[model samples]
Every structure is written in structure tokens, then in C-alpha cells.
Target: MASGLAFPSIFLLESHLTEDELESLKRQIRSLTTDPGKTDVFLGKLSNRERAQFELRRLGVVTVEKRQSRTRASARADTDSAPNLEESPAKRRKTGARAPSPIVISGSSEDDEPVQIVPPPKETDTIKVVKLAWFTESVARGEVLPLSDYTVYEGRRLLAEPAIMPSPAHVSRAEGILKRAQADAAGSQQPQGGKPHFMQARRKKFDGMPPPRPSLTRMTTSEKERVENLPPIPEFLHTTYSCQRPTPVHGPNDKFVEALKTIRLARQLMGDKIGIRAYSTTIATIAAYPYELSTPSEVSRLPGCGPKTAELFREFQNNGGHVREADDDEADAKLSVLRLFYNIWGVAETTARSFYNRGWRDLDDVIDYGWKELTRVQQIGVKYYDELQELLTRAQVEAIADRVLEHANSIHDGFQMVIAGGYRRGKALSGDVDIIISHSDESVTHLLIRRLVLSLEKAGLVTHTLTLSTANSERGQEAVSWKGNAPNHGLDSTASGGVGFDTLDKALVVWQEPMEPADQEGDKAGETQPNTNPHRRVDIIVTPWKTVGCAVLGWSGGTTFQRDLRRYCKNERALRFDSSGARSRVDGSPVDLEGYYGNDPATDMLTAERRVFEALELEFRPPNERCTG
Candidate 1:
């Protein structure tokens, strides 16, 4: 129904329904599967090529063909003869290969052109999922682990202190200090009898301050008895959205991390006494929260800010820009190694430290010094550091997702897959692909990862395999509870259990590595082999349809969104989740996937996710809107 449904060429005969509309259609169809008629009507709206998406969404499948008729009427007419609910399975079957799949295209041409690529096999191996963990002892030890160390991204709330309005007391103190300073100047410049003037107490005023009263925060006798006992902090909550910690920012330059480190260290030394503060956690969010500004009120009426603080905030906003100083921090940290370390897809803090101990200070140095320490993804990150960081094109991501989805289908029935992460957020380009897959057959599921990897590798489409961990994954945060420096988490940090996951359907893991320029490959020993783009990290997750929604929601998040969702679910909902299962209060421990959510074939990913949202008591977020900052 939308424009731009043109037929490209003979090879790309599929209608060009601009990828966004198509992916959206996929997400939508997956959401509404209860009605066969609705499914038909939805599919019936699209042209033949567009219908491919609907097919894929319904069955984890799709097929492609050469250019076909452009006339809308012809497509409309054909829609009448399409698959119907009443058709028998065998009769309904279409010629699998009589028609080529539209999804088989990879960017590389078949000796075709610079940008044009032949449709490779519908399978690929360069995608994978790695289960992650960090120890409690490791966190407490200040092990400098990856951001994966902390369990809770719990931010202290700036509560509107209705009862304990402590601000006036502080203001009174400041006013007293001002009065004392005036008196001290008026009386004597020198300390009186050598007693410091700053030691003097401030005068109190009876002005607008509220009446002194008993603390309302303390519960009344009746209220205490009536209030239900709330759960504790740091407990694991059952999450429909299983939290998956993300890989840290990496770069090719060893010096890059060093620079960041050195600068941070210098700030601690200088700014600590001088109050130097870390600005943006990542280079990405710097503009939103700067290092230093006088004050720009986040809201018109901040809790602590009286008229004066409000004025100051407004003045700061009006004057020099940011709340935090962006560029002024000393770039004292060495950056070469940081840059190099940045490229390693899953490089944790400990790993980064290992790189540092080895004395690799720069990208060139890492190449020159510690090549062995680098993972395939890191090497790729360095090689194409510039390119990988560049946002992915909408078209490019969609094409790749198609291949991965098809591979999931090949694994077996009850097997499901979906693309999550940034691309799911509707971004044209993405950092890397995030995929989830799952199925009911345990044995067949066992074979899913290996077969997928082998198939994809044999196709010559996947260049390298970086890491792999099968699902039923126990690789969640290792510590009982992350108490010290660790990554942020919501679902895992309930007062109940840890993270909820029984056995994942199966997780197949692979990573993309950077490909050297054609001419440059001659320099490396193993570089000449095709498909091995060293250092680009990719992940594939497999989950049963029962937990597919959890996987999708978990993986479909921006960093903070995941944290917030978990916070609300675990803290507010009183459910406990661990990496392997969910805990219920009426019962004893975590519930198995089948038991946690009832059995239903239609309880697949897109549908199941709706269930999770319903449990969370929130609106359903389509893939595009899911990427909340």
C-alpha cells in the first residue's frame, strides 16, 4: 500500500517495500496470530514480494523469486489464490526451490560489482551468543571487570521530600556562614583569640519553614500492622524480560582506553581535591548530561531547589552551555591501548587490565605487541574501527537479519528467532546484529547451534567464528549479588531470586571479524581465507517460544531501557528471576519455563512478548519504539 514498491532487477525481483515498512509488518504480524482471518487480511494487503515478510513472520520462513509483475491489480488478484486456513499441509506446500528466496542476498557480489552482491545460501555462521558472568568476589575485589560486574543500575531517587524537607536546614547553614563572614569582617580580620570564625553556628529564622513535628516517615502502630512486608533489595526477580548485559565499548587503539583511563585517574587526583567529575558514561550520551554547568533545572520545580537554586539553574542554562564541562577535563590518560581494547567485542575490565599489564598501549602497539591477546572481533574492530562504528544502513541490517532468521528455521519446528538490539529500535544502521532463537525439541535443539554454524560456514558467507555458548545458559552474572563495581541490572536484582531462565532453546554463537582490504590480506598468515572478518562481534540467542518473548524483550532493549524495565518488574512486581528460572512466592523456588508461563503453541516470541508486557502492566512496544535511552 505504501510507495517505492518498485521491481529492482531480474535478480532482485522482489518488490522494494523499503525495509522499514517490511520489518514493521513482520513485527505486527507476529503480534496478531490468534486470528487466521486477520493474518490473511494483513498478508492480502501486500504485493507478492511484500507477502514474503508475512510468511516469514508467521512461520520463521521466507522465499525469494526473480522480478514479477508490478501491477497492483495482479498482486491483488494473486492474493486470492494464496495460502488459506483451510488448505491441507501437503496441498498448501509451494515449490520450495521453484522460487528462490528473496532473503538470500548478501552484500558481496558474485564477482558482480563493488556494491552488488549475489544472494548467498539462506544460512550463515558469523552470528553467535555468548553467555556472560561476573563473580561477587570479583566485584567486591574491585576487579575492574567489564560493566558486567554491577547487578543493579539503581540510581538514587531525587524524591520530593515532603516530610523531611532537609533543604531549608542547609540553606540556613549557608546563610549563617554568610552572616558570620560579614560579622568577622566587620569585627576583626584576624581570628578572635585565634578561634576560627568558620566554627561559629548559624542563626535560625522562623520564616517559611514548616512547623517542627514528629517524623511522618516513621510508621504509625496501625499502619505498620496493616502494611504488607515488602521484599528486600538485591534479590533476583522473575523477569519476562531476561536481562542480558551488553558488551562494553571497544576500539582498535590500545591508547584509546589508556587515554580514557589516564584522564579518569588524573581527574580523580585533580578533580577529587578539585572535584573533577566523570561526564558522559560513554562518548554517545555526553550532550545529554555534560560535566559542569551552573544549573539548568531538569524540571521547573526541582524538590530541593528554592527560588534561588532555580534562578541559578536558569542562569547556568542561559550562560555557557552544558551542565557538565565537556572538553575541559585533562586528557592526561594514555589512550592508545584503550583504542585497541575498544575493538575486542567482549573484552571485560579484567581483560583490558591484562592488555595493560602486557604493555600494549596503542592499536599499533597491540598489533605490534599483543596480537595474541586480541579476539577475532577485536582485530576486526581495529581493522574497520571506523566502518563498524558507523551506523548500519537500514537496508543492510534487514538483509542480514533475513539470513539469520532463515537459519533459525532450518534448526527445526518450535524453533523461533528474531532480531533485537539497535536495529530493532528502527535505526537504519546498528553496531552489530542481536538475534534470539529457540525451540521445544531438546535433542534437535542440541544440534541447532552446531548445524547452523557449520551450514553458515560451509556457505562461505560467514568469515569467522568468535565465540559460542549454547542456551539453557547459566552464564548470567556469577556473583550471588553484585555488591561492588558491577554492571547494572533490573531483572537479576530482585529481592527474590537472580535472573529467570530455565533452559534456553539453544544458543548458537558467532562473531564478525574485520576483513582486511583485499590487498592487505596478503600480509597476515590466515587473513587470505574468505568470510573471516576478524573482530566484529555478533550474537545469536535461542529460547523456547515460551521464553521467546523474554529473550526478545531482553535483547530488544537499549541499555537503560532494560535496566528500567527490570527495575519495575522485580521491584514493583515482587517476582524473582534468575538466569535459569523464575521464583514464585506461593511455591518454593524459580518456576520452569513451561510452568512459569502456560503451554500454548501460539505463545511464540511476538505473542509471548505481549504477555510479558501485560504482566509488566505496560504498553506493547514495537521493535522500533523499543530502543529507549
Candidate 2:
């Protein structure tokens, strides 16, 4: 009787239902022990078969009409029921049927009929569309009701299945495995005395001694040599603080580091923030390693590299410098399309995934199907996707930096600038340019980004401004003040425009150099000027003189180095560091590390930056030696 009340997997159609109404129905469905899935029964407000089919198709479900012939349907059901003999006991229990006890027949043959474990009709791929009132009326009556009157459509699924329902092939394989396990257990019974047969076999395998662990026995020639002449581990590597280490541009294990970077990129595209952080630490540690990697054990010895990291390294070595997961990630059709969308200037991982889910396979699809749904910045990004992804050579980057600096000084004289990011890290090419600008006077730096952007735009050097954050200036050029150790109390939420760390007044813009005079001198008959310079992405950050040190240090280091620097400050020094300034974590007081070099307001920006390193009790790492990417 209880088995008669079991409902097939049911899916709720979101169309034609209010949010609250949908949630209410979902709660009732959950109370009835019906979980969400690709289901044979679809409950909805729909009343017609065509409307039901349209709703399913709209949600990416395709179906076909079930055969109306009773004989054929009965034959198909019989064939399907035979396979149910392999269904797991757990699923049978879920359907309110008791699992049968295992029977061991002495002379049972392979050709014998399969033992039925439960008494219940098997479910099929035939779908039925039931009106919403059926569910509500059934819940009101406090008993499961028949669906014959409420069902509007009946069809065979073209392609869909419940996720938890194992295929017949899988069930067959599982049964075989279970038989093998039972046979092994029955044969391995203790023989009258000492130990089990398996235990005796293990003892005889290694001459009565326990076998050596796999890791210790798999050393290669280079690994053996590396062990013999082990290099002195750098003292800084022991701390796990990237700020304490010097990470050069080209490390001894750069090739391996680059390979790991591919995996990190995949993690980023998948929006796995924790995985990204973990891989970043490992990548940074490998990038800073002084010796070449010969074995997985060598990687395992590093601070952040765990056993999994070492195993991946071994796999990487075996695959001729490629990680299998990274290769698969790159080759995945969905991920490849996602990567294309992610490379667009303003599209984040979430946005890229959203675009893919919307059935937009490419940029053209996005433009065609969802152009109006995009933000202004995203539209601009799509408009210049190829141009934005083009790499900028060092010379071109320098030119852009020079132009930015010139524009900054034009808005307010005596502005000092440092070209940060990949260019400062000695990369031959950069995807974008990051320039940090500062003025000795706080008043000059306050709200300076707006004027600078206006100046650049006026000169036709700036095409679009994506973001203009003045959170630092809004807070009167102050650092984020910390609250006492109470959750959600006294924190300065307005210090930064976005979340975490950085709060400097900055402008994220698209830049294109103005046409040269020679190119501007086109035919006198009103020909348009040819702008040969390619469009480039640029970030201009403005910082007050007092906290210029923090700005330079924060903006110059690689992503991991900057992240670990802030982490080190919080954990070791009880302070918070960001592009805005430093503040004591214990209380909400600012920490002035800039004035240590000199009382002079006009001190050189590099000297101020060095003063920060000295005050933080860390060695000053040159920009080129801070490439922990």
C-alpha cells in the first residue's frame, strides 16, 4: 500500500508561476519526497500538450510522442522491466520496497534467471504533463491521487534521464563486481588456524617484510642525484610569504611553472576561487624555486606543494610537459566557448557562463541574441574583443605610459608615475598597461583620476572609461579603518568601491594613440585620418603622497605576491595593507610607513616604497624580482 504512494521523479516548470508560488509548490513537492530532476512527470500551470512541449523545449528538453499502441507499449515495458533486476537495493528501498536477503544457491549457473530484489513496477522515459492543481489537490487531501484526469500530455523522452538512475550497463558491471567481491570473501576464509588467506599472501609477497611505500621506491636518475646533492633551501621559502622572497622573471623551473599556469587558468574559468588560490600559491612557490625540478618529490618538498601537487607534477612529466586535465579543459567544447567569452574585456567567469547557458556559442551569438541585455562596458568589450586581446610590446606599453604620465602632469604638474604590472616585471609583451601616479600634495591627488581621464579623452588618447573609482578620495584619502574584533561592526565599507584590499582612486580605460601628423595629413578632399596605433587597455591609479609607497608596492607585484603581502601583514604584523594605505588591525588607527625615509613631502616615490619594506621588516624586492605570477 505504501509503495502505491511513491511518485516518479517530478520536475516543476518555472514558466507561468510567480517566484513565491513556485517556491511554495517546490516546498510541497519536497515534503512529498519528490526531488528535482529530469522527470517523467512535469507539474506546471500549463493545460495543453503543445504549450507543455514548448516549455520543455525552451528549457533545453526535447521529447517525442509515445506509441499509442497498447501491444507495443506493453512489449517495451516488459523488456524494460527485465533490466530492473540489476537495480541497486538502495533505490528499491527508496521506492518503499524491502530489499531481499542475498541467497547463495550451491549449484547456481550463469544462465539462471536473475533474482528479483523487490516488487515494484519499473519507471520509464515516457513523460507526462500534469496540471498544477493535481499537486495542490493531492496535498490538500493528504494522500497521493491518480494522475489520469490531470495529465495533459504523454510522450517518450527524446533525450533525458534522472541523474541518480544508473544505466543497465552500469548496473550489470556493478553486479559483476559484487559477485567477484563475494567470491573472494568466501574463498579467503581463515584456514583453521593463524591468519586469513589474504594476510598470508601479503606476508609471503615481500619475504615476510612489509612492502616499501610507492613514493620512496620510484626515484629517477635525476631525483637520485638531486637527493645526493641537495641544494640549501632558501630561508624565505620557509615563511610562505611571497613578500619575503625574490621571484625573478625567468626561474629555473619556468617551463613547469607555465604548465601549472594552464591548470590555474582552467580553475579560474570554472570560478573555483579556492582552487585558484591554492594553485596560485603552488605556482608562485615553483616560480621562485632556485633549482630545476627533477622529480615529484622535489615539488612536494616546497612549502605550498601538497601530495596532490606532486602527483600532478609527476603526471605532467609523464605526459611530456602537459597536464591531462589542463589539456582536457582546453579541448572541452563548452569551456573553449567559455574561454572565448571570458577573454572579452569586461566579461567575468560568471558572465561568460551565463552567456553560454543562454545558448550563445560565440561572440556573434552574444551580439545577436543578448546584445541589449549587456552592460554598456560589456557591449564595448564585445565591439573590440579582438583588438583588446592583442598583446602590447614593451615599446608600445612604454609609449602609452608616457602618454598617460604626460596627461596626468598636464592636469596637475609635478606628478610622478611608475609603470607597474607585467611591464614592470620585465615581460616582453603585456596584455595591458598599469600606471601609478602620485603627487606630493594630498590635495593634488584627491579626485585626480577624473581630471586625468578627462585630459586623456580630450587629446583623443582615451576611447572609453570603464570604471572611475574615487573611494579613496571619498574617504579623504584615508586607509580602511579596522573595527574591533567584532563581526559586522565599525568597518569602513565606503573605503573601497569594490570588495577586498585595493581602494586607490583609479580609472580603468580603453586607450588608442592619436593619429600621427603624417597620417593625419591625408588627401585634401576630406579623407578620414588613419589611426595606425592599436587600441589597448590601460589602468591609471592615483595615490596621495603619504600612502604612495603602499600604492607602488601593491600595484607593482604579481597577483600572488600582492595577495600574500596583505596576508603576511594581517597574520604577522597585525596590520592591513592596500593600495590606499596601511591600518592597524587591532584598532582603527592608520600606520604611517611612508615618512620613515624623510619628513619631506616631496621625497622620491621609490624611496617612499623602500621605506615601506623597511618598516614592514622585509627586504626590498625590485619590481623585476617580484614576478611571482
Candidate 3:
């Protein structure tokens, strides 16, 4: 009987474990579930009676033992008939048996040994299927659902997976939907045919809309007061980003923009680069405004306008639509220096200041003493200073463009050219003509700048080459790639303004219209040479046919407009925009615009430009409307 009796054994239950312990126990249970033989060694280590109890525990059987003293043990010989506590709780309840109490085991070795118990099967509650109407109602009420309520499932099981939150694209879509709905609601609220008198009165009161201004001569006292007290236009009419605004070639606020731009230019002339940038944003904003401003309140509503600008606008209004100018000896001297510095193409405010500090006063002083110190490009700039200062008429630029195109096509039959810069933006006159050249045959684009300039120079159409650098030449391989008017010897060779201004294969030349046969005959007949045709500045940029659109777009800039476009591409599309091409910033891969709008670059350049906008997920703005500055 003693041999058959089982020694006391401790049993561990799932309810007794902590969260971390339960996790570890579950892992162990999964291991056993896959291979039941894994528990053999653990069971073999126990004593015979303990092993029997562990086996019973493994089989979901429980045992309880009651101890009696040695003297009382002989009196009770029916220990085998003792009630079993190893029975399931259901069975015990049915037989009117009390549940077993928890026992504390005591022993140094017993503390390390715990009996493993399988957890009972969990009961799953049926999930309520969510209806689509609930989502619609929540969205209608502008209520966002709790994050936890959103769940992802795999087949029938509720997966313990993370939820994908809404992205910017999703939020934009939602906002668009809401705006359309609001517009619809407003449309429905309007009365059919004619509005009721009360509805019209309500609209007049709540709209905060401005009434048309009457002529000063015809205005009644009450009407004048009403016009003066009207609220400024809504903020939505103005946008923080200049690229989103439409600035026509000729704007209603031209005078205000010009005045602000003059101040900005003065700041630049005084070497105030920070001030120049500050004024640039505001000037661009004012230039894009569609209406001519009449009050300080109107200027105050613009995005970049500040107190100073508002005050300036009010002063302009008081002075009958003109900015007040100051006349002084000191201002005249500075203006002279500003005009002189501006004539040098490669020189900026810092370089101009450097020249000023060196005690150089005028163009003659630069020509006499500072001639040797000037950069090769600056030397050419000073040589043709007066000629370059003269703005070219649209007809002059077009004729030059046509001549260049004729020369280019003469060299290669399929060559293409686009007149960019201010001319492309429909300006009546431009400071200079910028032309972008390309060819469907990519191999022709490799050294096209040198080839075309050489052809033009031979034809006597090009007066002088200020700069003719291939892509490799600009990148500092002048020894092998440079082919232009200036010698490779003693070149500055460093990048201008830190990074190179542009990366396209390009040439800047002094061009004069070829002497017409009549003019040439007149020259031979000594008719004073017809004013010498005044050598005008021309820039020729060469690019591959695939990226000619990018070159044209980059070159046809209203300075601030180009800056904002590049910023938008970088921040919104993860792209790097340049004259050469647009590329993904992520992997440095060239982004092709052809697939975006199904346009062939080999045919139409404007279509290609439109495709670039589409590929970047940007709205296509016409060139004339891009005069942001």
C-alpha cells in the first residue's frame, strides 16, 4: 500500500501565472503541441510516485491527499476510497463536491519544479459586421472614428495587425469630397429663378461682399461711406505659395509690384541679400493680385504683405497711384553705382561691393585700373556694357531666334529651338534673348553648343562669345571640353555663385543682326552703317531631346517663380528639378514625363512641358501666367 501511494505534488494553473509568464508558458505549450515526445526527459526525472501524479496531471486528472498520524493510520485502512480533487470543476459541481483549495509547496528543490497545465479553450464572441451607412454618417458629421475601432482581418480570424493611418493623399481626397458636398448644399439653398426679398436681404447682410465703387464725382455721401467701410476680400483669394498664384504677363498691380521691386533692387545694390529675399516674396505676392488695390486693408490681406508694405500701399493711394521717390546727393551716387554694377553680367551684390571697397567708382575706372582684376567673363561684360544694357524689342528677339534656328537647322536638319526667358512669358521687351536648342538624335546634343556657336560665329551673326561651355567644361574639364571665344588659359575655372547657375551645355554671346544686303550696300555707300545694329546679348542652351522641356521651362523663369517651382518639386514630389532634367531624389533615377500625358517629346516641346507638370502632380500653368515676380 505504501509503494502504491503517491507523494504530494504541486500543480500549477494558468490563472496563477502573470502576463509575461503566461507568454512563456504559451510558447512552451506550442512546442509540446508540435512534438509530444519533447516532455519525456522532464517526466523521467521525477520519483515513481511523483511521476504517476505528473502523468495524471498531464491527463487532466487531479489528486488530493489527507495525512494521518502513525497511531491513527492503522485504524483507517480505506484511504483508497478518499474523494478525488483531480476531477474537472464541472464534474465536482454535479457531485456536490467542494473545489480544491490552493496548496503552498515548501522545499528548496520544489520551488524550481512547477507542474505544467494546459489552458482551457477560449470562447470567441461573434463580431458585429459594421455597416457602410455608419461610416457615411460619421463623415457627414465630420466625426473621425477611434483608431482602435479600425481593424484588419485575415479570412475569418481577427488579426493582431497594425492599422494603416491616413496619408496626405487620403486627407486631400477627403477634403475635396467635403468641399464638393458643401458647394452642392450651397447651390441647393438658393431660390429658383428669382430670390425672395428676405433671402436677398440675408445674402446682402451675411456675405460681407463689397459693392462696386461709384465715380468720385457721382458718389453720394452715404454711398461713399459704405464703400469706405466695406470689408477686405477673403483670404482664399491669396495663396502663401507663389507657384499656385496666377500672375499674368501684365497685372493690375504692376505699379505696386514695380515700386516694391525697386526697393528690393536697391537693397540688392546695397549688398543687403537678406532684405532682397524678404522683399522678393512680398513683391511676388503683390504682382499676382488680380485687382488694383485702393486701400491699406486690401494690401494687408495679401499673404506676404506686412505693416511697412501696407503703409507704402496707403501712401501710393494718397499720392494718386504712384510711389513717392526721394531725391538726394547720396541717393544719386548710390543709384549711379547700382546702374554700373548691374551692367556686369557675372557680378552680383557681393562682387560689386568688393569692387566698391577697392575704390573703383565708374565704368571708366574699371576699364583703366581694375581691368586686369576682372574675371574673363566680366571683361567681356564691361566691353559690351552699353550694348547689353539696351533692352530688345519682341520683333528683334524673334528675328534673332529665327536666324539662330536657320543656322542650327543648316548644321543639322532636325534641330529644334525654343525662345525662352521673358520673351517666352509674352513680354513685349526683354533684357536678353534666351534660346534652348535640342535635337531628336541625342548624339547631336553632346557637343551641340560648341558646334552651333562655331557655325553662328562663322556666319558673322555672333559678334563675340562671352561664354561657350559644354556640360563637361562647366564641370571643370575645360582642357578637354571647352571650345569658345576665350582661351582655356587663365580662366577662373571655379563654379559661379557656389554651385553652377545652370548645368546645360550653353553659350552666352554678343549677337548683332547680320548686315542686310541693302544695309551692306549703304555701308559701302557710306550711310553711317545704320547705327551698327547694337550688339544684343543672347544665351543658347543645349540639351538632349528627352529633357529639352525641362531646359526650356527652367530658362523661361520669372526668377521667384522658378525658385518656388523647384521648392514645390522637392518638398511635394521628392524630386530634384534643374535645367538638365527632373530626377527622383530617392534613387537618383531620371523621371520620364512621356508616359504621364502620352506625349512624344520628339515632336512638341510645349506638350512635353505639360507632361512634366502632370508627372510631378502639379497643375499646368501657361508661360504668360508665370510672371510671379
Candidate 4:
């Protein structure tokens, strides 16, 4: 095989010598793909230069000369061929007439499907939109209504944030108006129920709509080709019913589930096709700009605007959707509703729809109806429901933390306790208070915990309790000695068998009980959003002192932060840390931080803090200061 010349496309040039050389050289090339057995066959025929180009291509990279090869040839062809002149083809389906809008179906209450979704661009300030005449009347057509009146989920979460797709009702209304206008353009009287004067006002609003179109006339690169190949509207895919969140919490949360589902569906319909930029970061960057540029080119001067991505933004803004295809997207519609309902606690897909159909729209109705009818725990749930809805302020979090510490101190000597959640996070607010309790004397800790809950409840601080008993040291040793022994908590072998987050206790209680319930479903399924109750969340855990570090570390985190921490701990530190314990990944050697070691919860927190700091070699900082992106 030649090492100097480039290879032609697989579909194009082939020769006996090339084929023979390909087979011979194939024996030497290594395969990286899953089909390892076939790598050499593709590599055998290529010359060294071609192989180099192929490797780069394999990495999703296109070489300059390779790109230039087609482009230069095309340029020559374009010079020879007459430039085709034509209007952009219309996207509205024209099978004698346009189609109707689609009816969206979000998932059940227990499901975590998105009800509504905003199609935020994966790139710039542009949305790929589809334009068409009003859908057929037979379809479920509805207009996007005002935010406050319509849903529990915000538009960002509840509906397909289609840049230009009108609700069925809105599209019909617009179509009716436009038909009259088009008729007026020809020679005709205005249609009945269609007031030309009123349409003019609506038309003014329509004309002021955002513009969109993307063009990559900047630098020529393979990335440009990649961008050109991608359409703005996402390709429709298979659907599945899955829970987005499974919080074993009590409350009316149906509306929230629907909303969340809608959000997911809309996303599936939109920018999922192209790109991976952070939305908050992207929005912040765009928002910082002084002037609004509807097209991507206008903002090309800004940093991070790759030529290919910029084209996409410009095009998205100009067009209501992708360059073509105006079929009513059912996926987006379904997602819109799901997103609307998922925002509420205890809300799921099925319950959200029920509430929507019954016109029991808001949180208030559910609270009034379900509070008394739900479980005692759920009844307590309704009491603090509103307070829980609000993110806790820093002061409120502190008060909760002190209350948690009070219970911890009383548990036993050498018992340790630390307040986590948003308060320890140093954030100004928190959703719920988290308390981690542990003790060095693992043998008697469970006994202390049981007593602690009873006392706290009697003191009126602990409103509800969920206990998950764990194996003592002796019990663990005995289990290991036995051929088959399992912790009754039902945690898997790979993870904790203990219930809850760990072998822990969970409780939800309001500081002040404003209203007591009779008999009601508390945290029951398919519950509606609360309207009458003020409820809040509270989580508590008790791990032994040896595992205290892991418990605290897990507790003091944002989602992504925790993810990265785990990666670092496992991959870099080769450590295993769970709510129960922190041990060596290679061998279960216990991690012991001697300083401040104790069965006392307070001392345990200090020791765990010190241990983590030492392991990471970082300066000692309170949980509040641990926030990391």
C-alpha cells in the first residue's frame, strides 16, 4: 500500500492492487470500535496519508485538505453550472390543505415524564420553528394561555417551548384571520365571524414576532458540514413512561408531575438534536449583551460563537422552525402538559391530568380536599406544605438546625450531630433541613436514636418519624460469618440494605401547627397540589461514626457537585464512601480520623470534616462554603 497518496471514498475507487494491499495491510491496523474484528479490513487498503485522514475522521474531525478537496471541486462545478434561482420551498404540508394541531398526552402521576418544555437552543439565542396554516379542526388545538392562570408548571417546564408553534386554538384563530386577509388580497367579501378590523390588531402583533434563519457563510470547515446536516427541530423518537423523580414525600403533587413531563417532551421535540452548551451559562452570556440581535450573525462578534453554531442561531430566529417539515408535533404538546404538573410536590402524571380535567387547577383545591383524607403523615405534610413550597431562608434553616442539634445532643454521650442541607451550605435559603447523626459507640447508637425520636416528638419539635434500623457491629460480623445473611432494610448487596437514604430516620414537621386535620390521605398517590395547607420538608439520618464522614459528605452537596466529588473520590482517591461508612475501595479498610473522634454527634462532625479536608488537602471550611459548580 502506498503511504503518500490520499484514499478515495469507499463507494468510489477500488482496484485489484488496492484490494490486495488493503487485505495485507489490514492485518497490522488495530481496531478501536466495538466491531474489533473488522477494523483491519477497512484499514488494509488505505495509504499512510489516507490512514492519517481516516483516523482524524474517526475522531469526528475533518482535515483541511480533505474538506478543501470537495469544496474546491464544488467551487469549480458551481462556476461551470448556472446558479439555481428559486424561492425557499414552503414548509406547511400541502396535501390539498394543511393538517390540524396535535393533542398532547402527558404521563401518569407516578411517572416522571415532562408535561411541558421550552425548546431552548443548544447554541445561541435562536429557536428552530415550524410554520403552517391552522391545523384541521378535528385535532386537539388549543392556544398557549397566560402563565399564572393556566398551570402549576411554568412554560419552561410544562409545554413545548416551540418558538413559533401556535396552540391549536391560537393557530385556528390566526388561520381564520389570515384566510380573510388572503381573500381580501384577492377579490372577495370578508368571511362571517371574521372581523377584518380586529384581525388588523392581531396581525400587528403577529408581524412583530421574532425572526429566524441560520447561515454559516463564515469559515469553511467540516464542523460547518456537520451543522448543515443537523436540522433545528429534533427527530421524533420512541417514547417511554418513566418517573422523573421518586421522593417518598407526602403532599399534593400531581400538578408538578404533569408540568415536569411536559417540559421533558418539549425538550425531546426541540434542541436535543444539536449541541450541549449549559443553558444558564448561555442565557447569562446572551443577557449580558446590550443590544438584541435576532440573528446569530449579529452576535458573531461575541466570544464562543463558532461559525457553524452561529449559523444555526441566525436560522432558528428567522424561521419559526427548521427549514422544512410543519407536521403537528404530538411529542411537544404532551410534554407541555407534563411540565405544567411536575413542579408540585407529591404530584405525578395521572393525578395532574385528573386535576386539569376536573378544573381543580391550583394547589389550593388539593389541600382543602386531600389534607384530612390522607395519611396522618400526609396530613402533617399538608400543614407545612406551603412552607415547604418556599425555599427556606437562611434564618429559618438555622433555627431548624439548632432544633436538630438539640435532639442529637440528648441521644447519648459521644453521639455526633451536624446540620446539613442549604443552611450548612451557606446558602441564604433551604428546601428542607438535613441533620446527620452518628456515634462512635455503634453498639448502643440505635437504642439512643429510638429514644431521641420519641423525645423530640414529645417536645413538639419532631412531628413525624420514619426509622430504618441498621445492623450493629456484632450483627454485621455475624452476617459475614454466615453463609447467607441479609439486612432486613432491603438494601441491595452492592448498596445499603437499610431503608431511606441510609440506616436512617426521616421526619416532616412544622414548627407551629396552624390547623389539625381529621382523617385524610397523607402523601398518597395521585394527590393534587395543595391550596390550604402550609407544609415543609425535613430529613434526618443517623450513620455510625465510622461512616459519618461519608454521610456528611453526601449530605453537603448540590447534584453536580456531588457527582464530581464521587468521581474524584472513586477514580482519584480510590475510596468507597456511603451513608453507612467510608472504606478503602480496593480493600474495606476503615477510614479513621483520630482527632475529635467520638460517639458524640458534634465531635463526629468535626472529625469527619477534618478527615475529608486532610484527604483532599483543602483548607477547612464550613459546609456553607462548600458550594462548587
* lDDT: worst 10-residue window of model 3: 151-160
Error of 3 at 606 (Å): 0.7
> On residues 271-365, what C-alpha lDDT tens digit does candidate 3 reach at each position?
56556777888888877777776666557657887666777776676677666652231266866686587668778777887777778888888
Model 1: per-residue Cα lDDT over 1-629, one tens digit each: 21122211111111333354445544432233433222212222222322334333354322222223479988887878787666566544443445442322221223211121223333321110111122223334544334322221111111112221223334455565577678777985653343333432222222223444432123345534533332221111122232311212222222222333344444433323221222112211211121222222321122222343334334334554322222233332433444346445555444655676777766677678766766675665566665555555667666666676676676554566677677766655666666676665535555366677776677544655654545353433121232221223323211111132223433323344334466445545664654434323355555544445566676665544555564564556644433223444333344433323354544456776776666656666665543323
Query: What digit string (tens of lDDT, one per residue) describes model 2 on residues 1-629?
Result: 22334465678887767567777766656533233334678888887776777776676665566656678889898887786566587766666655544432211334333332222223336778899888777766767789988988887654232123233544555665466557668885433433322221121122123444554336678788877777767887987788789899999888778778888888887777667888999999888888887777777888998777788788888989887877888788888998899888778788888898889899999999999999887898899888988999999988888998887777768989888778888989988888888888789898888888998889898988988889889989887666443222211111112234237788888899887776777578978776877788888888888988887887778878877787788779978777777888766689988773366543778888998898898899999888888
Q: Which stretches of candidate 4 lie over 4 Å from their true place?
A: 1-33, 36-343, 346-384, 411-416, 466-500, 503-535, 587-604, 616-622
lDDT of each: 0.42, 0.74, 0.60, 0.42
TM-score of candidate 1 against the unseen true structure: 0.45
**Which candidate has the top score in lDDT?**
2
* lDDT of candidate 4 over 1-629, digit per residue (tens): 12222321111112212344345433322221334222211211223343334343453432233111367878788867956664244533322253434433232222212122223332221111111111111112343222222111110111123334344544445655577678888989855543453222221111223433445545446545654554332111010100111111111322222222233334433434122223222222232233333344444544334454355454444565332111223334544454344334444444556655655544576566654554454444444455656776777666666766677676655555677755665656666667676666666555455676676678766555633344433244111121111112211111111122333333434443323444333566755434343345666566655545656766664332454344455556655444444445455465543333454343446666667657654345455434321
Better of 2 and 3 by lDDT: 2
Those runs of model 1 whose alpha carbons end farther than 4 Å from true positions after fitting are 1-295, 298-324, 329-340, 353-359, 374-387, 411-415, 440-444, 471-536, 578-581, 585-588, 592-597, 601-603, 618-628
Question: How does each model score on TM-score?
Answer: 0.45, 0.66, 0.58, 0.42
- In candidate 2, residue 87 scores what lDDT? 57
